[model samples]
Target: MLPRGPRAFSQAAATALRPPSGSAPERLCVAELPGSELAYFAEGGGGGDGGRPPRGFLPPPGRCFSFCVPSGPSAGERVRAARLHRRAEQRLSREPFGPGGAAEVLPLLAYAGPSGSRPEKGFLVRDRRRLPETERALEDLVRLILPPPARLLSVYEAAAAEDGGGGPLWRSLWRLQGAPESKVLLGRARVAGAAEPALHPAAPHLLDGAAVFASFEAARASLRECLSVIPEAKAVLDLVDGCPVHAKKGDFPVIVIEGLDATGKTTVTHALKDSLNAVLLRSPPPCVSQWRKVFDDEPTLIRRAFYALTNYIVASEIAEQSTKSPVIVDRFWHSTAAYAIATEISGKIQHLPPVHHPVYRWPGDLLKPDLVLLLTVSPEERIRRLQGRGIEKTREEAELEANNIFRQKVEESYLRMENPACQPVDASPSREEVLKTVHHLIKKQCHFP
Candidate 1:
């Protein structure tokens, strides 16, 4: 244990454990109100059926949310948990075939044994419609939060504090173990149980809610507070000094080109830089490049935080460079949010938040590009381009090639962003054609001469 938490920011994160919202059941373990002492296990349904638990209810330790509260929770924990539960229920209720449907739900488990302090795990309830692929993704989530040989117990009708109160109702339990090398595939993981509890709100954020970070200031404060274990704290701080307090606007046109790797992003960005006499930039700006791989090795939240922070650094640069000439970026928030949101949602575009949803909107704080050009290439061509690289592919790139659904989800996410939305261009044509198309879009969208 990292000797963490009596409050929100601990050496690591010490979990604030509590019982469910409801009272204990017959022959069940129970504790008094605020149930911080212990969580009770019962053998009865909320209905007075007196039906025993589907199986024996093992009195496992109550699942504590370190993010919700540091150690022992204050009133803040209940409020936060309630807020999250509301969001989750709303999202789930809107979800296709969610509640009332015969859709089978699988419980997700997360566990960390006093290792690094915080328990980095996510819990979710996934439907069984997609079968094998979804099944594999669920397995990946399990391996992500709790790797193999760390079996999870499937408990049912487990009471929740909300059920006791009027929180979103759900009844399920699962055991989990942490795996450092684990890379959860974002969406649904198949735990072998039929009890589909409501999804955790942060499920979409997935562990650290890195995708939720839109403002640099918020991200930095959180990073400093929660990420004491980061390898180069002083270096990170010094680097932060160079970034603008907030994303600033400049006089010149700012165009961001976004696409998967080998989708001619670099080529198009370079061309735009030359053609428009613009400054070319890439995210995780070279200034913060030193920290990319470090955070990449950590969990999803930390890794995403690094990228999120890097965007701020780039924003500062953009503020400066745009004053000199038009700025063309190889990738920007489009890439970050698109990939993050795409990874968060399961199945297809339909499952994603609707166009008007806040999740699809641009961060109010970040600098917006004058125009964002999204390059699209056919799957076959993209694969061919990847082969030509003769370079090692990133995990995401490999996933792009292997999972078409993932690719579509990413593209859809890009299209859904508001407040300076990304415009699509077909990169399937010849390089000259692609360049011409981009130039045309810039002139039309940004009035670039």
Candidate 2:
């Protein structure tokens, strides 16, 4: 349901909330949202008594669409953003993109230009299995997502003056090939040059280098750039280089346990270390832990390289120690790539580089673990654990709660790798029980004595 209130009600908002005029999803999923959030779905004309969204409304794909929520209700706006984002996630999980299938949907948040005019947003329907099926789906999606530019224009006053309002700000759409260069052109607002209204084909300058490292050398250059901003990060970089790469692969197995904060990964890892008589090592090894937080605050490229470099450092440790006994690791490249990929993109999972994409592939230079045990827990349980721990949450931990899409993508990306795929372990069980289960898996897989 859209929000209800005389001020909030509008024909454009209502129309946009529904599946565009002619296209309707095969099925509509209805979930029980809290009564407090009812206002968001209730806003606009014809929500009637129940305040539900109009029938035929398939929850918009995992992208936020403008005109979905009526403007000016700050509290309602926040609540609706959360709900719509969740809805988008729901749709994406249900309909994953396969080979030749399009994975992303774009919901442009159009706003009034200088003089005021409408704009558009869209998505492509695709399937690797059938061309006709793909075409039909794409058409339905395009029609269903008919963005109400007029409604966005109606609410465009506050931001217009600052950005320099004009007419339809842009008219362009980029092909979403599911790659590093992919982009979604949301509605453009007014800008500096009013004499000519040209389309902005590129994504925002801030996102230029999001979640990417063209090569190790590129990563090094970018790392140096970040270090220049924070002198302390340079020290960490030096310390990582201080540890020489191991000359030979270890005789014993190296196992890595990874999961979000409060998922018992730390506890399980230490226990496994003792049980397996294994040496415990962490990425951003103890030598560099001092600056882990420092680099964590820096932008994506630098932060990832810091973690990536730590893996090489730990690889050195693993190679040396596994000669004597097994090596147990707390985190590794999976953490680095997953968080990087998730943070770099917005909206649906489809927007992310698909599974098996090169960006998701493990780095060639870094040593691969004998087995990577990835821990998983439900969102409700993960939150409960975080609250119980009472420690200051890391930025990543905080984001896990703040953005559902980001959190989901991180876990998905972690499990998507193939060079050394992550084996999912349910961490929701008792710590002792989880350890026992993982022990069985480790012993069976590693043939550990």
Please give, for residues 84-197, the per-residue lDDT of candidate 1 as tens digits: 333333333432425664222322223222122222222333333323333333334444433244433222212223224311112323333454323222111111112311
Candidate 2 residues 263-309, lDDT tens each? 88888998988898889988758887678777666544456666766
TM-score, cand. 2 vs. native: 0.56
Q: Pick the candidate with the highest TM-score.
A: 1
Lowest summed lDDT across 10 adjacent residues in model 1 is found at 63-72
Off by over 4 Å in 1: 1-210, 447-449
Give the alpha-carbon lDDT of every model.
0.52, 0.52
Q: In candidate 2, residue 58 scores what lDDT?
A: 22
TM-score of 1: 0.60
Model 1: lDDT equals 0.52
What number of backbone clashes does candidate 2 have, counting pairs of residues 3 or more apart or in separate chains?
18
True lDDT of residue 64, candidate 1: 19
